[model samples]
Target: MQLSETGRGVLVSGASRGLGRAVARAFAANGDRVAVHYGTRADEARATLASLEGSGHVLVGGDLADPGDAARVVDEAAEALGEAGGGSGIDVLVNNAAVNLPHPLAETPYEEWAALWQRHVSVNLLATANLSHLVARRLIDRGAAGRIVNIGSRGAFRGEPDHPAYGATKAAVHALGQSLAVSLGPHGIGVASVAPGFFATERVASRLTGAEGDAIRAQSPFGRVADPAEIAAAVLWLASPAAEWASGTILDLNGASYLRS
Candidate 1:
């Protein structure tokens, strides 16, 4: 289905780089006014804004790990986009900020292991929940139809031995999206998630170039990990009005890397 030419206000968290940046660009390309949200990376976020195709794009900065900051980020985005587009609130939200620090049980110490889990859960799960709630409320108050797309991980199903916390939080995110889909459907809001495996983002580019590259590629029959833009495309589709019935769905973008029965 083709997207509407009329511009909508979109807020993409973690838009400074990687999949977030790509998602922001994708929405902008479709004529939406986007709020590019970053965490302590103003320069990179500006670069993302500059790369977008349209005007009315704004830059918002906040650390998602802090609930207060997450709320503020949403408010700022809504206000900025509202001023630019003559709308009162955001039309779509993409929750893509997360922490993926590896803390292999065997090599890591107990203190660090515990810290890793806490940080990952705080940022990946709690923050997403907070932002979703804020955006949902705004959408409801404005009586507007909207979309929420959570960036999950294939590790949620396949497992992440080196980063169990990351996997657990992603799985929780998928579940959260499902719950929101049900609760918000009556209000004309669609909620869904995407679980991607081994994307070729800057954060993992070093590993993709090292000795483990081939093995990672072999995980998928395609013999290549996903490009950020591919993931961004899926996000765009899910956020479209055509995907309204797809609410509560968890779309897997793993390229057949880890099939779940």
Candidate 2:
């Protein structure tokens, strides 16, 4: 089994802003060329590309909910970064794109609830599966070592009362990673996931500072939530060659807010 430890090509999905952006920055800072992928946030994606620490980074845009678009996103990223790495495509794939909208069973109508659940499943679960297959196939075909790190959520274990779809899909993601890790081990491919609690990201900045900020922070003994960069650091490590043995492991980044026995 061969595992690479030097500079590589990384593809970060949903990297327009927030945790995805932080993960992209972390990999770029570690000397990896990054392909920043976005759904609808083109300008924000460009900003993320600009913030990377090194060169050879590129921008890729596509709606991952669609299988065709998902394939295009991965192909474009590989084409763009392959040249820099001698035709060896992405060495790392970060499945960071997800949707967490509120659709409480008690409050939401049946139509809206079903729609939201389908949307969440498509973007959060199916897209991750599709991208993972695409990248893993390329690695296997090329006979190269690679890594796939999924961005799961604490809600997968703790439960999201108002967003059951989000929680359920994230749980599926965790399970998917474990299954892939086992299947891909023989190919020298490492697959792992991180389940993070509330973090300081642009998407939830208001919630962090508004009426529920105290309650949210109080959930963790640290009296504060995570910084996006903190989660990114964990992702960077899991993608490294040293973390090959950690495949199939789901590392929690919840700051002691949630625990599973």
**Per-model lDDT:** 0.91, 0.94
For candidate 1, write residues 99-206 as lDDT tens digits: 899999999999999999999999999999999999999888777788999999999999999999999999999999999999999899999999998898888888
Q: List the residue pairs that clash in candidate 2.
A: none
lDDT of 2 by residue, 32-108 (tens): 99999999999999999999998989999999999999999998999999744566679899999999999999999
Clashing pairs in 1: none
Query: Model 2 off-target regions past 4 Å?
Result: 83-85
- Estimate the overall C-alpha local distance difference test score of candidate 1: 0.91
Q: Per-prediction count of colliding residue pairs?
A: 0, 0
Tell me, by lDDT, which candidate is best.
Answer: 2
